[model samples]
Target: MSIPTGRQILRLYRDLLRYGRQLQFTDKNYFARRIREEFKQAKNTEKVEDINFYFQRGLALLKNKRVV
Candidate 1:
């Protein structure tokens, strides 16, 4: 898969940030651990073409931010 653009990555990162913030009052470790585990599972797949998709998507979603 192609590398995501800075804007795309930023967008994804923002999503993760929001999710993290939402979970802050709860169990932050659990949220982080789940994300980690999901990534790990994605890594195990044998399809080379799709290997980066999961990471790229995650990064993109986590990085998005609204300019104030």
Candidate 2:
């Protein structure tokens, strides 16, 4: 997929955090903290490849973590 726009990235971040809270077996706080730390680490990403990579990674994470 094309690199995600800023708004899309923000939405993904929010979704990840929201999904983390719904985890039944995992620790939600740790999941949330990791998601926050990951986004913070990626905050300065400027390269298109890096942005795309993170965007795709986030999508995969959300897909895997989301509760049905």
Best by TM-score: 2
Candidate 1 per-residue lDDT over residues 1-68, each given as its tens digit: 57545465445545665676665355767766766676567645666456467655565554563111
Q: Candidate 2, which segments miss by more than 4 Å at Cα? A: 66-68
Summarize candidate 2's per-residue lDDT along 1-68 as a digit string, tens digits.
57788899899999888888888998899888988998999999888899899888888877776433
List of clashing residue pairs for candidate 2: none
Error of 2 at 62 (Å): 1.6
